[model samples]
Target: MTLFRESFATQQSLPPWEARGVQSWCFLFPLSATAIQRYLDEYFNFAHPEPAPFRFSALAEAQFGCLTISYYPVIASTNKANMLRYGPQTTSWDHLSYNEMYVAAPVLCNRVTPDNLLVDRQIVWIQPVVMCDNSSVVFATREIVGIDTMHATINLRPGRAPGSLHVDTQFSGFKTFSPTTAEGPLPFLHLETGSPLPGGLPEAATREDKAFLEGLFGVIGGVDLVGGVRPTTTRLISLKQFRDAYDLRLATYQAIVASTATHTDVSDLRFFDPKEVDLDFMWSASAEQILSSFLQLGRPGDEKASAPHEGPGWDLVGRQVKIKVAFAYTNNAVYDQIETLHTFGAE
Candidate 1:
């Protein structure tokens, strides 16, 4: 929300920091890397508390401008993935990581601002992820996130498409929590000022972005969005992908609760799901494409909106797109999770 630029943008980057603030607005202290390691390993693995408190050292708060709202420590990766849904089969996938924070707040920057304009007044921070056709990953040291004490499953009835003959879905889901264990700190990426994106933030807002920021407000207030951290993005899974993955995550969660509760089948049970497969996709883009292809008028997929000067598929593809749509989910209970964490119908 705030725009910041500074005199010393060129000398802004801190030596070591990665704690990212989502709409949460979290920032890190200038601790030694050794101390930071201890914090991450020993003391930082939980959600934030009510009022969505700001986490910052006095110096950090002064430097970054806004008090951070919330942060993701050790963010493995933050980017968007989108799958085009078309064709008779309606066979496609889309997952946008509303999980990554938009670094709208101020901090260090690599470049100095124009003297007359402002230094560190504001710098957009962008994650220049590889093209949608490509992606990369970061593997951090794996650690066990804590388990909850109670969980409840809700059954969802199916529905039919309006004026049509397509089956919707039927499935089950649950949310568990350990209310006793309060939240802890997180370390995120402190991208400098003057990066890119409007007002020097990272990615632009999409549907998932709206869901995440709104849900985050509730979570920080101690309501437990889904008995856990709400998912950071939204998803569009095929009906089959929904049924199949929901079954898997539920099964995995069931086994986890069973073992944590009684430890009776700890040996017999195991977690099984493919990693490295696509589960989520966001709709973000690089600076060039965002400008070049974005339609100044009309809907994205509308052929009539395509100008003759533009080439093939130009109107149908690119950023800032919206359309009238209808979607179905197994039910509303874990619908957000289906959008965020469920991993069926992966690419």
Candidate 2:
């Protein structure tokens, strides 16, 4: 059974654009209000201009960096009620007052001093803000000429996490695209009692210890070793994962990593179960149709059509298409377990 489902009934349609051919395109252009003001002053020749200033408000200061704009074509629906209800000015999609639509600014700062250095200090700072939000209010301005088409440009910036988990979740959902699977029972490598593996540690004397050791081995073996030695003997396992095997789910993985980094006590950890979600869709057109659509959105007006090398995620659609399809899983839990054969009492 699916863990979650979207309520299509809640969706509202706005308008349709007119164009030619079977393809549609959309664009997202992210820019700060400061940049917009600069563009207006330099290119459009604004009559009045303010002198360059070093200090500005926190909001203004936050807008001085890079931003993100997302764009996607709107597929019109035949339902007239849906269209009129969500049309243009009356549409909730265009209303910026909605909390979910508002962009938030966040600032991160850190300071550190080296242990051995006589006088060494470091400080890190990050400020992210949302600049603008825009969308095309598609209206049936003219009759559909063969196939419908429209071009939209949305101004965006680093904003607060969109309250709607749909977008982020969709991105996360794609991570397991070609997940590794176990086709058969894995071989067991037993360590003789009192015998240590190559690392100088004796074979685990208890089942729990053996399991912990195996989990550590899995993580180390998965990575390439330098000079045939693992980077660190410290095994990094999620607190949630550890809890799943032992029934503790109140702890967090980040805390575990942090504690281990500082040599803090981590005697007890919480755990949870891994949740999985999947999505599948069938399009009428061949794969080429989808590829062409993505390419057009990715590099508008560019003739060269190339698939992005980056793994599937937000980076794939960076500063290009605003509209995208994605899915995600949350509250997933995993556990590290020991490998050992146990015999129950039998006649």
Estimated TM-score for each candidate: 0.16, 0.15
Winning candidate number (TM-score): 1
Model 2 lDDT per residue over 1-347, tens place? 75322235344232221111111111111224443333223322211122211111212222222111223222233334443444554433422110101111111111222332223221111112111122222212111111111222122222222321111211102211244632221110000011112333345556754554454444334532321212222211111111234547521111111001111121211111111111111111121232233222222233332222223322322222221111111111111121111111111
In angstroms, the error of model 2 at 278 is 25
Model 2, which residues run further than 4 Å from truth? 1-37, 43-45, 48-60, 69-347
Q: Please list the C-alpha lDDT of all candidates, in the order they appear.
A: 0.20, 0.22
**Location of the lowest summed lDDT over 10 successive residues in candidate 1:** 254-263
TM-score of model 1 (CA atoms):
0.16
Please give the lDDT score for candidate 2: 0.22
Lowest summed lDDT across 10 adjacent residues in model 2 is found at: 187-196
Q: What is the lDDT of residue 337 in candidate 1?
A: 19
Instruction: Provide the lDDT at 178 for model 2.
Output: 41
